[model samples]
Target: MEWNERIAFVRKAAGLTQEQLGQLLGVTRQAVSKWESAQTVPDAVTIARLCEALHVSADFVLLGKEPEPPDNAGDAPPYALPDTCPCCGRPVSGTICPVCGYTLPTTPPRGPRYAIVASRVSFVNEEDRAAELVKYCGMPESYAKAAVHQMQEYASFFLLRRNLTDSAAQWIAAHLDGSCFSLRIVQDNGEESNDALLTKPKAMELPAPAAPKQGGLGFWGVVGAVIVALLILSFF
Candidate 1:
């Protein structure tokens, strides 16, 4: 492909809008649009920036082939963790792309509630869970009522991180043993919402090597146990 075509291809493949690319490149959306349309081309400096942002070699952008790495520390391990979404080329280790909601093709299919057996909990609606928290944790009635929304906001950050970084996936795996939290939206008709992240999983970023176990639960597992312990205590 021509350089113009190549630029467009890499940008879209990188899961960046023209505006986003322009923002990264210190140009206007119009300029990026013009470049993709072949009305103009990026200068040498811009080309360098594009390569760095995309984590691709200049040769690949210019000639569509990545040159071989040197036989030294320069060469990355063949099985190094993914820093970008394979589908959209956006960096993410989450089950789905945050930018385009592209699920990893390799992620396994899931049912209504998919979680690691150890990490798995009952799929209660947020309202019910909030009520339980209030009653069980002895939290302020108002605070308990509003907890779900607050947690959801925090969850959004987790979701976004899941979408943009593979690190989320690794942490989930190492801690939960492949058990990841999924929220389901139940419709009045008794059907689950059609969101893929809720029902079907997408490509997940694999975690790096885990630390040595201290003969106990992982970090999240311990946290979960503490929550359960608190709930149990509240009953008394």
Candidate 2:
């Protein structure tokens, strides 16, 4: 596809309108329209901004191809030894720092640990759920949002099953940061529900959750089913 088509495709895929993309780029909607119409091409800086905003690579936008991976894609950073401690800012070499006595961590920090739990409750969007997590669980806002999204995509199948509440709880617990932070999924039983697709993990480190062929029961579908079941139980 051409650059214009790629821009339009990515923008729509990201759930953004021309005006929204314009606002994000600090340009007018007409400007975005022109770009999408192939009347004008984004400059180098604007192209970079576009890539960042759309969460895509420049190569994909320009050539419709994923960028080639580096030869040492999975290798560690080129430099060795402690240039400075990430915690204390003291410089040292050859293992533990003498001044701070802090040893380098075995694995890189993957943000704060969190666990989510879902009962037979109404579905909540990730944004609101993220806010609740930060408000009640004392989680970092960015981390909470990302983690909520990850949980949703991987566990939507489990989320829809009323009898599998225990399984959902177990899944969350297993993924929680066992060392320091205790991220808990607080149940939100509000009336409103959404049917939006959850954001996917950018790169898969492990296998994805086994969901139904139809992309798991949508949030709204689950909500409707739960409400009907409740009504039936009440009538009985």
Candidate 3:
């Protein structure tokens, strides 16, 4: 193709319109149009700008020459992981297969892992709270039930599970927060600080019983006197 045609090709390949190309090159659309129509040619400085903007070598644009690949280009192996997991045959994310836990041998070492801990819940019953844990945190029903029971009965906080990726942990924490679970993310080693604690709903406290009014017959006082009179009558 002629150099003029090459300009049009590269501009279209870069997904830029004539006006957009002109904006990048600090020229008018009419100038870009004229260059494409062979009515004018870009000078050396403008050609350099065009090459930079279009990401094409000057030889490719001027002499229709394709850039040569590096000598060791073919020596490099292709990507080690497939678009889908080989074991589960499902689409995968990051380095690990979330479905079947299939990990690529060539995958790089991951960053710090995380663990999610449960502290409290707005739900009234342990079953409902356990269901929320299972839904949001993806824990098994048995494990979730046990965790909820532990959090409710014996512990102020329960370690739901550990060894989670950063993204997975964040996602679980957000969803648990949305579901009214008081939770926190900590390192896989189970270490946590006050700053790492997410919002935890305060445990509901029962109101203290009111003191009886002095010199007045309260309902309980009347019931107590009636019980004494019945005891005396029974003795008679």
Candidate 4:
């Protein structure tokens, strides 16, 4: 499906009218209609905003695609970690996933965000979930928190890829309890997803080609060398 189609589907799936979706995206209802109609592509940030609003992975919304979920989603749980996961049913403490060879993290994180039981119950399109997490979960909003967002996004990417290992890749979805970092969240209930939104997700984008090397190749080097020679002659 194209992004436009996905966007339209997501809006409707979230039970948002174009006017509602438009309000969330800070655009007019007619503009939202145009986008759904494919009159123009939404800018990158707009796509990101829409994904958060829908609670679907951004890839699903923008690319009309998702990284495949992981390889062991359907496998029987390994016995070593207990039939049920003490830590979110992600088979661990084994040399390899008997089911699918995915390596567990070197060490799992702990506290509020660590366990599935602690998962936050979020309202659909509820961006306030961010503040709730920061306040309630003891999740620090340092630059490091951005690392966690990357972790979540990677897991989502893995899911879109439809790999069986995708579920294992993420920290258990945050208990839709409340928010910490100003995230946008959605719960279709029809869909099994979590969290809501991130206030500022941290990931690197290519830096605009360093401003195109600025005017005239070798401009600085040649000028510097001539200035150096001029200084030497004056000293002599």
Candidate 5:
């Protein structure tokens, strides 16, 4: 059966009418009808919500593929469906959370890290700028002072710092004046390496071509001189 038919089958198995499923998914009944009739396909986010509402996996909904049974099924404990989504605190009864579409992580959660990058910056008093950084960006006074000093010296594209928390990066991007400083936040991949924004490097000056060696006689001149000396010796 097609994906649309699969959606219909799952909805019926879950004892949900089209209107009820629409209400659960925050969509109109007509939208659900279109999905069942194969007139329109739901977007990724809506499909995720549909999976949650129907208590089915995406593979089953989209590809009609049933989940494989675990190899040690007899030894495993029965999995219980959650009553509410932990992320958004919304009512749900599936492995996938409907409100935030959160699923149980198979791996350990990595803390997100962010970086603040500056493309341009205006001249400001160091003390005032340091104070602003401290107050607005949640930067330490000493670090803020050092950052301001670096900005003054560079006056071009440069990274403020990496390994910052998301809130701090957002605060720096939001609170800094746009005209004075073009700031952006970049999320790091939980690595210790510093990633800088792309920027054009200064054009390097090439040394001027070396002037031709001064006062060097031509090969023809040397040959002519040798012939002249031979002639003069013969005459002598």
Candidate 6:
């Protein structure tokens, strides 16, 4: 590609306007515009700076095999987690892209309320789960509508991350305010469990991790022993 065209394409790929590029380069927007139009060439210094700013090699800036970026990042969420829908951060269920309002795919409902046994949850890969859930979500559920929407949003996120798609990721990113989502995924331990983070659950209960034994009155095993001793003393 011609140098000017390369400059313009890179600018756009980086999602910058000529004006922004100019500010970064400490040049006037008209000068940047002229360079893009092939009316004038920027100095060697500016060319090097542009290459650095664009995260491209000088060669890539001057000449690339493809001549332009494929705009591949357009589809993915701009960022991914502490940045998920504020209303439902990393929601186990959601209908709209909390960030973009892009209607995420959902599982339509069937005759029965749907859920996998926590042990059975891992049986489905993200794609299958997403597909099944989407189909189920499409079903009508008066009470579960909000929960279904949340699930659909989560399914989209799971599938997007499952695949190598950028648009899927970008939907999440755009809402994080130029930041990425921060989250930790835990594997299921073959028990049915509700998302601990959810404010409410449909039917599934949040699995409580086993508690440590404590020497306290409310400790059941300890209380049982105390009751047994009290019974012995009362008999005496």
- Give the TM-score of each candidate: 0.33, 0.32, 0.35, 0.31, 0.32, 0.30
- Candidates' RMSD to native: 19.4, 23.9, 31.5, 20.6, 28.5, 25.9
Over 44-144, each residue of candidate 4 has an lDDT whose tens digit, in order, gives 55655555445466546654556686797657553432232232333333322222222343234232211121222323432344333332233344522
Model 5: how far is 185 from its true place, Å? 1.5
Tens digit per residue, CA lDDT, model 5, 124-213:
567877775665545678987877777778765556655555543553455555555656666655554454332422212222222232
- Please give the TM-score that candidate 6 achieves against the real structure: 0.30
Q: List where candidate 6 sits over 4 angstroms from the true fold.
A: 66-236
Evaluate residue 163 in candidate 4 and report its C-alpha lDDT on the 0 to 100 scale. Answer: 14
Which structure is stronger by lDDT: 1 or 4?
Answer: 1
C-alpha positional error of residue 79 in candidate 3 after TM-score superposition, expressed in Å? 5.8
lDDT of 1 by residue, 1-236 (tens): 86567787877766577886776667899998888777976665566666655555555665566578557744544443355553335565433343433334433323332221111233246566555334322345577546545554554311112132233333333432222333221211222432323333344334543453322344344434434433543476
Q: Which candidate, 1 or 2, has the higher TM-score?
A: 1
| Worst ten in a row by lDDT for model 5 | 202-211
Whose TM-score is higher: candidate 5's or candidate 6's? 5
lDDT of each: 0.47, 0.49, 0.60, 0.41, 0.59, 0.42
Lowest summed lDDT across 10 adjacent residues in model 4 is found at: 157-166
Angstrom error of the Cα, residue 71, model 4: value is 5.5
- 1 against 5, candidate with superior TM-score: 1
- Please count the clashing residue pairs in each candidate, in the order shown: 9, 1, 0, 46, 0, 39
Cα distance off (Å), candidate 3, residue 216: 61
Estimate the overall C-alpha local distance difference test score of candidate 2. Answer: 0.49
In terms of lDDT, model 5 sits at 0.59
Best by TM-score: 3
Model 3 TM-score relative to the real fold: 0.35
